[model samples]
Target chain A: MKKRGIGIGSIFYGTGYGNGFPDVSKAVAQLKSDGKIAIYVGATEVGQGAKTALSQIAAEVLGLSVDDIVFINEDTSITPDSGTAAASRQTYNTGNAIKLACEKLKRDILEVAKDYLGLNSIVGLTLKNGYVYPKTLPEKRVSLGEISESLESSLKEEAVFTAQTTEMDEETGQGAPYWPYTFSACGVEVEVDTETGRVEIIRAVLAQDVGRAINPELIEGQIDGGFAMGAGYALYEDLKIEKGKIKNNSFTNYLIPTSLDMPDIEKVIIEDPESTAPYGAKGIGEPVMIPVAPAILNAIYDAVGVRMTEIPVTPEKLLKAIKEKEMTYNEGKN
Target chain B: MKKIKLTVNKKEYMLEIKEDTRLIDLLRDVLGFTGVKEGCGEGECGACTVIMDGDIVNSCLVLAFQADGKEIITIEGVESEEEIHPIQQAFLDVGAVQCGFCTPGMILSAKALLDKNPSPTREEIRAAISGNLCRCTGYNKIVDAIERAALYLKRGK
Candidate 1:
């Protein structure tokens, strides 16, 4: 156990996200000897890639491959009591915790590195491919096995962290603000069938401001997922709620966009690395879905002159608007 | 209970199930294949889509007995150990999965479409996966992934 350099910083307003920067080499050493690591951050994969992202964070800190990390997304037993993996906060908040733990581990390893080579700064020490090396001397790299040997001789300590923010002004729903806000916008074009009231999204161009992308492929996957859900919300998807009961609890009653309802989409990734994140990456999970519903709603109005305030524009609703407009025009002509 | 011998992912599994047992249940509970999920448990949502003899069918709608002696392909069978299925890779590469609950079914539906028509128009691709519902990502990316997969398969890569 040694003094660790760890700082938790709030990155954005309204994001309810904070991060702890950790030392990587030490965490790996601890992992090598500890056999298993526990995490309580309330990030659930649920297909949002939170598990993978968190694993990547641990892997990056410990100088291990993504496979070396195992995240317990479910079973609250092993996980930290952080918040849900929503608001694009997991990558920022939970990732920081992994970094903090890694920092403490790094401190332990530094002591070992000092005693091993009798040096003050491991500045010349480069961590690459799961090995620590003196940059000037490539062959002078210490294998993880050797580091683990040192960890077993040394005393160990717990790495605990929690990311938090103050509650909002209950009346106005405003607070200190999102610690970090991921911004995005989408441009959509649609073709509305005058006869059938079927709206087909012709093309969609999206621009997202992700603080940083931990995994580019995964980021886009999140974006695509958001769009699908949003598309369903727009033209063909709706949850039928009647008498406070979920009428469309089953898929039959709830109409989500199918592959048939898919629209042509173009993804534009914008990266503004947040200083607080690992490699300056922000969370892209929830932001993908937040702006989409509104974007689609706006696009529908753009395509058809009618502004359907409500969502899931059923054909009947669109037809009713069309008829109302026609009647108004006819009355004027008369 | 009737004994149903089905071939899934090139492996034969003999299941003694009730006649009313949906293929989805057989795959999930009986066979321990969680890849084929049950979102709606009805045909309305394509969460339980699987390929049967090169055609996509909702496993929830198909009775387990109907799948007896049938060639079934779940998402697990789509890929060899060496590489991922073209559709799955496309989905991953192009960002098609989120809350991946609907992904297996969505990919299978896309596979069925591609098997029937190698080169599908945008409309056709849309028609192919139209049954599946994804709540996280908009359908735009799913369609993009399918379109990309079609090109990848055409190039024989």
Candidate 2:
């Protein structure tokens, strides 16, 4: 692992689409020829499963299973220039790139299938378990190995596809729609300790409008993970920043949500598949985090009569607020 | 450096290490169990949590020597060969993993709770993992996964 692998340099291509990019196909072919493998582009799985999503995209497009895909995403030299894993764009953007490559491979295979099977159009060909079959003739199938051999015999169609997306404006922060967005709504119920200023999440319902449920189980996992992160942001987690340096860099000062802190979460995956996505799937990376803080805040307000607007709503803060409310009530009586 | 032996996930390891080395480091760097990660490297975040003698303790705070001669269980030791441990499987099935960085620790925390009390109320499960901070999915699904796993474990499956 390179020391700079997780640095800011790996995140932005430029400002938007063509920012930190590489000659994708050339890199892939060259890497393969050199016995180098395609590392799944992005940061390590650190809990977001960027690698899994990337593999799903490649497999769906290449007409292969996720097991066949091996990624070496940690290295800088061998992989495509995948920006950061933040904001959930790995699947949204990188998946599309792999999907595009897969589509190309599929088209080329269909042409071979068309010529060999005496068919004119490749429109109705569907990929099933690495085999191509026409809807009318589901029983008739051509193995991917056969197509691979045919392609290898004819042309070296071994290349990777690269994509570029634009960013927000430098000054105005307004630009063409930045990459597609993933959306979700978090509904939460909390119980506040009237005495201790502790906020307990009793129950939570996360309704995510993911462009597609590429992997339903994984999608839920993303939401669950986000919920914990968000809950921490709301009730417990705080990075105490003084100037720009973190004062509470250690865990002792910065409080995070524990299992005792969370409520029962019912993850609702609303799949509104995006055609722009590899398989109608949009990235759920940041969206899961986006709504969590607000949801927990709302729940806290609902739980307690006092509407505490600030974060980490520590017991001390809550106690002060309660006292202030009492003082205000006494003054009103006078 | 004093030599110490510890049983981790049913396996024994002997090491000669400094006093300041954290159990989290010992597990990941020394033991080659990268599944246990350091999110906060402090006790506030349960990302370094592991089961020690059937209770959940943040591996970050436990000194390497303190963990010495104790029976410890990391995420890698949670499951048998044929199937995922109940907590792990429930996490997957319930969508409890997103980035999966905090997963091993969170699962281990849940395991600790279930081991002590096989049938935990929802509140108990939440209290169990409150130390773990996940930045991706919210704690809703994680709690759900724990509840589901508790049921399965209680059923003896």
Candidate 3:
């Protein structure tokens, strides 16, 4: 016989290393003569779409499309230090740096465009589609190609942003350690096999507070990937260690969820907006996986009346718990 | 050491190899098809997947000598210089390539499946690429990319 139950889990996570720790990230934006914008930073992209999101941020700031921003990253010698790509800080930290650099570049371009357009006041002027022109005057526009020809060399702007945080008192162990916090909630449905203690996830639904979604598709990808990892953590990704040496260290022993292992997933994106974050967007790289394990565990308890404290919730452990519960009931009746 | 003749990406190569050399090493190190990534180096992760004689096999598990007189299709040969393969294009348009370590094998698996079926249901597509391990995008977009690729292939675009 198989019993089914649904469980819910929620969490609030603070992105970036906080607690009065100085968190800084840097970026340099160069306006190429060909009218392409090159963004230089040291943020590593491990397939989490940091480069795409960062480029979107730059594009948002400079009134350019994502295609116009030539995103360059992960080179230490050429690009400046953008810190490590941890704590979900790349979007929040380095994104701000890129935003600032593009803003400066925009100002410089407008300065040159004012002279090219023969405008005394550069107030009504803006950049769009490789042209610098007044908002009202579409006819009196100068292309970026013409703007670059008048310049002696290409224009560049470098900027840096420090995350705001304060150290806590040692005794109290409290302070404003992290900024731009994010929250998420998850619901999971599972079927627990009473005969063999097998558990299967039927469906999963998650609602994430992503401050703002710079790239909605990328966010969807992140949430889906996070759920797979969380499912693995809740089910069967156990690493064996002996004498501090790891056994089952490779994929042959350790396993992750394949496409067949995943259930139907529904993602709900909540965009409340963070004022301090770039384009009012927060980092969700690490927070999306926080709710999956607890929800699955709770669902298992609901179905089979077993509160599995350990991960993997293997059949052996679940069956032992069920047998013990049955014995306690049978003995008490006598 | 042994001598083997194989067709890779429609190119014929007659090469001498050690009896112990795996096809992955031959494709990556010797043939310089670095697109054939070796993730697990074992048969579990299908990162070294290549199409051999119309079947998808883990190149890491296949010895170089086993490929003698066989036809192999790798990521490098998926498209011509002028146009990208529809599957690769769909992977890009759907934003399925993340970290991209598992892409070469994943794409080859999709290619083999489409070459056989041309119009696979979502479940069949899932079953086809289940051996490839991608920790980045989960499997949602990759699955969607394959479905989209099927549309492109059916339309003969």
Highest DockQ against the true fold, candidate: 3
Question: Model 2, range A271-317, lDDT digits (tens) per residue?
Answer: 87876666887677657766777766666555555667798777788
Best by lDDT: 3
lDDT of 1 by residue, A1-334 (tens): 1111111111122454433222111111234453333333555677767777778777776667776555555666654455665556667776776677766765666566656766667776765565766778777666555666666454343444444444567688765444555677766666777677777666666667787778877777676766777667777667667889987676556666665665555777888888767667777665665566666666556656677778778888887886788788899999
- Candidate 1 chain B: minimum summed lDDT over ten consecutive residues — where? B132-141
DockQ of 2: 0.53
Off by over 4 Å in 3: none
- lDDT, candidate 3, at B50: 97
Q: Using TM-score as the measure, name the better of candidate 1 and candidate 3.
A: 3
What is the per-residue lDDT of model 3 for residues B95-147, given as tens digits with 9 covering 90 to 100? 88888999999999999999999989988998999999989877988999999
The full ranking of all candidates by DockQ, starting with the best, is 3, 1, 2
Question: What is candidate 1's local distance difference test score?
Answer: 0.69
What is the C-alpha local distance difference test score of candidate 2?
Answer: 0.68
Error of 1 at B16 (Å): 6.4
